[model samples]
Target: MCSHYDPVLNAQKLKQHFGVDDLPPGLKPSLWPTYVGPFLRKHEHADVGDEAVPFKELMVGSFGLIPHWAKDTKIARQTYNARSETVHEKPAFRDSWRLNRHCIIPAEAIFEPDWRSGKGVATRIVRTDGKPMGIAGIWTGWKNPANGEILRSFSMLTVNADDHSFMRNFHKPDDEKRMVVILHEDEYDGWLNSTAEDARHYLRQYPADGMRVAVHD
Candidate 1:
């Protein structure tokens, strides 16, 4: 149920952590589709020495699956997220989960909340440590015939809520799901190279304790 997040890491953070600098131009195009402008500016940066991929854009802001055979884009609106447990078995995510596992989803923090009014009102949630969090993700490339251009899009993974107390009260009734798949630095390589089984093995470590959380402003 991660509906909102903030990118606390600008160009510097990306560079410092992953060693990839030189951001996409403006990076606006990668923001959620149908949303207004962008949450941040785009610049290319990386640690002083590490090499990273540079693209027309960097932030894959929106979350969801854009089915390879989709006739229209609306399907993604309802599929911005896929559960980590079944991702490898689900039709939409199965392929990507096994072969396209990727990372680098930078966000200051994501928001989740409970709405007693029977309406979804997101209460911005962030980590108390105030550092940007990276949500584990997968991306796909698409082509628009009208412009003969290629576009890359991505989706975030979610897990059932176990210890995130702030999210327990507002948990989605069906699953009481609140936790997201946060890849650890040690597991990045495994995730990036995992087969279906490997992907599941590494993602299971995300729910371990020690991460911080609080209501976002």
Candidate 2:
């Protein structure tokens, strides 16, 4: 249930922290790349939540999910995050996992772990370098049965943490599971256009110590 994450840096902050050349002009300014909040498409004519019309490159999606079917407007309250392992198999997520899976979940940091003797001690892991961490994810569309409206949303992908990784010790010996899949710089394109096989191929785990962690400041 990795329902919460943060983009310590986003389009607005991209130019300030990262080299302007790294990103095409499209991914900046429109959306913050999260589950909720913000009018990402600054363009006047763009549709608010439909996927049929492609949005400007400058404004990324406010959410990565394009819901296949949404019974109520409130389904979003619980669908912010979907587990990578199960997503490919679930009815709600399978379509997005195979075809509609195009997204880059940018973040400055993520929360993972270290294990105490019996309990889990949480830590905030930030990138070792100043550059932002862009985790892998999937998106889909939901059509509201009641109103006949469409909404796009997303979920972050997660892989198990290894024994020596930062959150490795969090679980019992048989189960040191972790959230937050870390993508390699070269692996970006593969993930954004990932096919079902690609889902099993490219999404690699981030290094255990690849990020910095601290108590909330």
Candidate 2, residue 71: Cα displacement in angstroms equals 1.0
lDDT of 1 by residue, 151-171 (tens): 455667777665555456565
lDDT by candidate, in order shown: 0.55, 0.55
Which residue runs does candidate 2 get wrong by more than 4 Å? 8-66, 112-122, 145-147, 162-164, 171-176, 215-217
Q: Candidate 2 at residue 114, lDDT?
A: 51
- Measured with C-alpha atoms, the lDDT of residue 183 in candidate 2 is 75
Where's the lowest-lDDT run of ten residues in candidate 2? 37-46
Model 1: CA > 4 A from native: 28-62, 116-121, 162-166, 172-175, 205-217
What local lDDT does model 2 show for residue 168?
A: 66
